[model samples]
Each structure stands twice: as structure tokens, then as C-alpha cells.
Target chain A: MMVPVRCFTCGNVVGEHWEEFDERSNEGDEDPEAVLDELGVDRYCCRRMLVSHTDLVDVVSPYQ
Target chain B: MSEEYDVEFVEREDREARFLVRGVTPAFANGIRRAMVADVPTMAIDTVRFIENSSVMFDEQIALRLGLVPLTTPPEGEFVEDDTVTLSIDVEGPDTAYSGDLVSNDELVQPADENVPIIDLKDGQRLEAEADAVIERGKNHAKHQGGVGVGYRHLQRVEVVDDLPEFEEQESQIVRGVIEEDGELVSTTEFDHDLSKRYPGKEVRLEDVPNAFVFHVETDGSFTIEELVTRAADTIEARATELEDAVQL
Candidate 1:
């Protein structure tokens, strides 16, 4: 996953919540907002980090 | 400047707190903010050595993640910048790696929040690394910031010019100030910023208290909110002492 260690805009640590966010978002059982709120990420900037991230690590690792 | 100030707690949580400091200058309030953000020292992973990695994340990325993990600061006079606390993590998993996985040499110097995830590993994927925690100030790097969301706003003064029927209906909802039935405004009321927004364009006007400040501080679990504020005040005092020494010299 292309998760950043901290939110670029607000500097809140967001990477820690990415795994759970990714899992629930994929499950489609709960809205992203509810998941984010449960994760204690209330700011819009931190919220955007989880919503827009793509897992590119798997795609690029083979080249290394 | 010698006037005594009143500190009233507005809200208190484990990691966040809000308080009102009356009878302080704006400069003094700002000094607290700057000190909390830059002067207070905290423990953070500063260096990492990789032993094995079959995961998708690069070694540098893993190290960066480790460095960002907030560590609990050792008691005052217990931390030494040159002294490094070792942290090692080894996991073979079809599961997620967490900050709790990293074991520290010192019990007092470990991850402040254990739930921080480092990486997700699939079956057959392995990751191993050793990290060093060191004490540092936030001015050097954000990873060492003792606290976050350290800020203050001037306390506001609300006055009612003409209490109309519309204003009277919303008066009960306003906790900061009491709107008497005869439209008299009380100055001793508590201040709440939301009150102004709840009733916009009413006969009320909000004014700023130049000397009164409402401060909010949020920690990253590195230290208690009380510790952060106390350290900030200590930092300000140290700076002032240095300035006095310089003038004497």
C-alpha cells in the first residue's frame, strides 16, 4: 500500500489505521465516514489520506 | 504583567485538554504554544537496521514508519541523547504487523500507542528490523514533537445590544452568557465560541479579550497533557534565564 506515515496536510499519523480502513472499506458493510470516525480520524485532511491511497507497494516490489 | 491569572479547565481527556488562562498577555500564551511544539523533548525512533525483509515495502519506508512511532518519554533526567534504546521486530505472517510487535530494551521507552500498524504481510512474507530510540526536540523534526494541536484563541466577550424576540428564544441555548428577560448582558458568563455561530446576525456582538486566552493541547501519547504544559512553561523559563545571563555578560 502507498500509505504515508503522516497526513501531508494536518500531520496526523494515519498509516496505522490504513489496514483496518482498507479492510472495512473492502467489506462494504460500513460507510467510509463511519469507519474513519471509529478510527478517531475526524479531520478532512487525515480522512482523505485513507480514502485516496492505493496499494502500489506490491506492484513495484518485483522490480526491486 | 504581575497580575495573577486564573486557569480553569474547559475539558480534559487522556490525550487532549482545553483550559482558559486569564490575565496573561498574548505573547505569554503564544510562548506556551511555541514551547510545547518545539522545546519539549520526546523519544522517537531515530535509526533503524534491517536484518531481513521479504515484504513489499522498502527498507527506507519501513525505517521511516518506525521513526514516526511515538515513544513514551522517560522520566526527567533519565533520558540521554547519546543513549539509544534498541527496538527489534521480527514477524512471519499472513497478517498485519503492529507497533506492539516492536520490543524495546527499556520498559519505560516504548511505543506510546501500541496499535500503530507498521506493515501488512501476506503468507511467506517476512520482515525484521532493529530500531534505536533517542530523545530529541520537535524543532529538529516533527517526529519528536511532544504534542500536537497546541494552540490558543483569545477569549471572546459577548454583549447583547437589543434583545429582540428572536434573540430571546435562542438565549437558553447560549451557555456562555445569560440573556436576562430585560435584555441585560452579564459579563461574568463563560465563553463558548460556538454560541456566536449558533445565533448569527442576532442583536449580540462578540468582542475579544486581549489578555484572556483559551488554550487547547493534544498529545501524541508521548506524555500527559499536564506534563506537556508544565514542560512548555519550563522551556520558557529556561530561555528567559539564558537571555538574562547574556545581558549580564
Candidate 2:
């Protein structure tokens, strides 16, 4: 049997059938948004929703 | 003031090879480019190319796991003189990482380049068990286009003092290790560049390495964790067979 793999970021199933949850588990549970980062993909920004100071720093401003 | 902008990556109108980033002001875009440049670590001169040009794609979650500072958007740019984003990538610096728990070092995040587990020969298993740990490590390293880099071992052969004294004419093999001017394995042999002055008792000769000695992985002048382990195993096995063949009276 295949082990279910939750998205690294969202901790949610990578994908699933919407109504097949009666016997399976939680349904309509939206995977958390990927917390965008400076380096690369955020495969772990699930449900926690922690805002970051660096993420809000002078990113829009131009560096000298 | 904080400003958040949606980064739209678009291919350049002219340069097919290079893509252009739109929606972002030149200053913001240049700042992002500079940020990537800073990521080169000590290889500050090393260049980073955002192939997509318009939008940069990456898994930010891993970046956080690595404890790297984030520069999401809003006041993003080279502004906010108080705040700075430096490239925490270890390889960019003057030194490259090796196979060890070096990533946890406070100075930089240099994770082990390779993880080839060496099975203890004394474990009483004939032939040897599957190199599960290291075999898997090698496969992982082979995935990226980088595959792996073979760092030079720079092994030096030393002549045993007692043997040298007894048989001034006969040649024999001996173990060698790096020692400081004070005679210590504190650093790489290369650090003993001034061998003559530091090691007054004996000079460590760099040119005395053996040809059969597996100093590197293969063609590349670099060393890999797997290569090192394999070389060591082969050496031990060969020595054991040689000893078996020798009818020591």
C-alpha cells in the first residue's frame, strides 16, 4: 500500500477526491498557503501561518 | 513606506537566453538580483542567474528550515539601511564544505556534502553487509546536475623514523598525518606550506605521495564521501589478501 504524502508546506494531502472523505478523513480542509521565501519554494508554510519580519523587511525597497 | 508588488516573470523580447522581469521597478529588481549575488557566500565574485528572469521560484519552507532570514516583499529592496540580506550559502565563501556535521557550525550553514557511512569491518559479517547508508547517500548526490564535487584529499606519505634508521637503504611504507609547526593535526597539510620552518625535527614532503593511493574520487581532482570510503575498504581488503598470501615464518 502507498503511504499518503502530505505536502511538505501545507501538511495536507497533495491531492484527493472532494467527497471521498466519509470513510477516509478530513474533507475541504484547504492546504495552508506556501510561505514565500527569499531562497526558494516554501513546501512547509502549512496552517501555522506565522508572519515573518524578514519577509516584511525592505524587500520592496532598493538596496544601495 | 512598505510596498508589495506581484512579480511577473516574462521572457525578454530580444535575448532568448535571458529573460526579463517585469512589474518590478528596476531598483527592486536590481535589489533582488543583488540579493541573489550576495547568496554566493564568499564566492562573492560567483554569479547567480535567475533563468526565469521574470519571477524567481523556490521552496521557501526549506529556506526557513535552514534558518535563513526572509525577504518576502513589502519593504523589499536594498532599502532599510538597518536591515540587510546576506547570502548564507556556505560554498560562496573561500572554503567549501566536506563530509561531516559542519552545517551546524555557527559561522555558516555548511551541511555535509556527502554522507557515506563506513561499515566497521570488525562487525563479523563475511564479505560485508550492504552499504545501505552510504550507497543511498551516493545516489542522492548523483541527482543534481552538480552531481557531486570531488574535493582533493591531498594525502602525504611519511617514512617511519625507526624503519628509516634500521634500513637506510630499503624502502617501506608508513602512515602519515598532517601536523602543525608544533606537530599537531590541527589543520590540512596544505596549511603546513612552510614545513621547513615549522617542523624543525622532520620536514613533511608534499611530493612523496604514492601513485596507487586513492587520493580522489576518479578523474576529478576532488574527493567524495563514497570514494573515500570505497578507497579505504579496497585498501583494507587488498592488505588482508596480501597478508594471507605472505607465509610469515
Candidate 3:
């Protein structure tokens, strides 16, 4: 199903990458909270961190 | 301009006609960008001589849930004051239908036998009971899959229950209203998608309705019987004024 996700600040479309990455990395004991902490997003974020891996990867480009 | 009021329109989810209006006050930009929401006769929009004084702004949920009006201008073009508050009236009419008076305490009790007398209660009892019911409901609804806290959902609306099999024998028109801690009246308008046909301009959310919560009549509302009686009397006075104006000498 298409994921429902939007930027918290401006309500813009980020991507399905975060949600995909979350489901894949949710192995072991790592929850969304831990993932968000590792990614350094302040605050609790939303109840469900609705983003895909592609969205998070774009924050830092390849050449950077 | 002391008469110019900045207006802002805020739209929200699942509802229309309700909007937000923020105002400003005279305290910045050398009084150039100053707005007040004081009571003023708004005949025409003229700068320098006419500006809104005293304004009130509410959050989106509050505005939609309360069904406020959609203002076109931002009330913040001028510096806003602290005490400035707006009535947030949207529907066009003289009687600002405060969501509070929607479900008054004095229900039109079907006249029983002459021996049975009317019942009345002390003040504040109804408000307290209604608040308690709302709190209890908030707690129950909070137990969702995500464990959301007691948020805006806590403020429910008043409802109008249609004919049910149980109440078929004794029919009475029931109008409900929800009360929030911040003093917002919640109820459905006649503007909801399907419910708009019968109630063309009123809509109250399902959970926010105070009907099921009204277990007792003597004390489970926002106002006392005496206050409602006063309102009824006022309606009569208004009707009298209308008759006097229409009668030919």
C-alpha cells in the first residue's frame, strides 16, 4: 500500500524510503525511536515515523 | 488605523465553514503595523479611521471543532495585544449562536400530569458532570493502537439524536453540545456531508456529542434552568418587539 508520509515542518512529501528502511532494520531490538535517535532527529517525531529509506538517504548526497 | 482589523482564514480536515481569525494591537512599527480587535461597526473597510480592536485566535482543531468563521485578512498586520479576543462567529445572523446555548439545560419537558412539578438544580453541577464525562471518554478513546495521549479529542461535541425504538413512545427533540476546557462549544453543523440536508448549517462530531453522557437532567449540562428561562423570556420580548413594529395603527 502507498505510504502516507509528509514533512513535519512544511508537510511536504519526503518518500517511502524511511518506512522501507525502518521495516528492514527493525530486526534485533532497534525500534523507530532508536533509529530516529541514530539519525539525530530531535523530539519524538510522530507516533509512526512515516518515511522511506530513499527519503533519509537524500539528506546527504553522494558527492558530499 | 484604530478600526482596521486584520483577518486570517484557516481551513481544516473533514469540515468546512469553520476558520480562524487572529488580530493585532498598537505596539510596534511606530504604531504603523498595529491592529486592535475592539468592538467597531464594520460598514466599510477604511484605513486610518477604521480598524478592528481586540481579537481572538484559536488553534485549527478548536476553530473547526467549534465551527468558526472564515476571515479573509490576517489579524496580525498590526501588533496584537494581550487581552484582545474575537468571538469567532462565522454564520451570518444577529444572534451569535454560541455553541454553549445549543443544548441548554432547560429541556422542553413534555407536560406530565398536573401533579408532577418541574425540577431544577443548583449552578455549576451540570458543568462539572459534563466535564467529568468528557474526561472519562477521553481516557477510554486514548487507549488506541499507538497509545495517543489525551489531546484535542478530549473536547467532544453536542449531538442531536433521532427517533430510536426505545424513545418512540416519548418523543423529544434533543440538541447536544460539547464543552472544552478552553471554553469552546462543540456540536455538529447542518453542513456535514450527508447530515447537511436536514440540518443545513450545523454539525457536531460523533464522540464529542453530550447526549449519551447526559445521564441525569437535574444536573448534567453547562447552564442552570434559571439562565435558560431568562433566555426564553428574552425570545418572547424579541417577538413582542417584532409584533409592535409590524402592527398597523
Per TM-score, the best of the predicted structures is 1
**Candidate 3: residue B194 Cα off by (Å):** 21
Model 1 lDDT tens row, B93-203: 687678889999998988887777788787788998899888999999899898787788776666667655654455433444222223233233333524554445466
Ranking by lDDT: 1, 3, 2
Tens digits of per-residue lDDT, candidate 3, B68-180, equal: 11111112222122222222222222222223322212222111111110111122111110100111111122110011110111224335554335433432234332232
lDDT of 2 by residue, B49-162 (tens): 222211111323222222211111111122322332233222221221112311221222122223211111111211100100101112122211011122222224333233
Docking quality class, candidate 3 = incorrect
| Candidate 2 chain A TM-score vs. reference chain A | 0.17
In candidate 2 the C-alpha lDDT for residue A20 amounts to 32
Q: DockQ of candidates 1 onward, in order?
A: 0.44, 0.01, 0.01
Location of the lowest summed lDDT over 10 successive residues in candidate 2 chain B? B127-136
Best by lDDT: 1
Instruction: After the best TM-score superposition of candidate 3, give how far the Cα of residue A60 lies from its true spot, in angstroms.
Output: 16
- In model 2, the runs with Cα more than 4 Å from the true position are A1-64, B1-147, B158-192, B201-206, B212-249
For each candidate in turn, the TM-score is 0.85, 0.19, 0.16
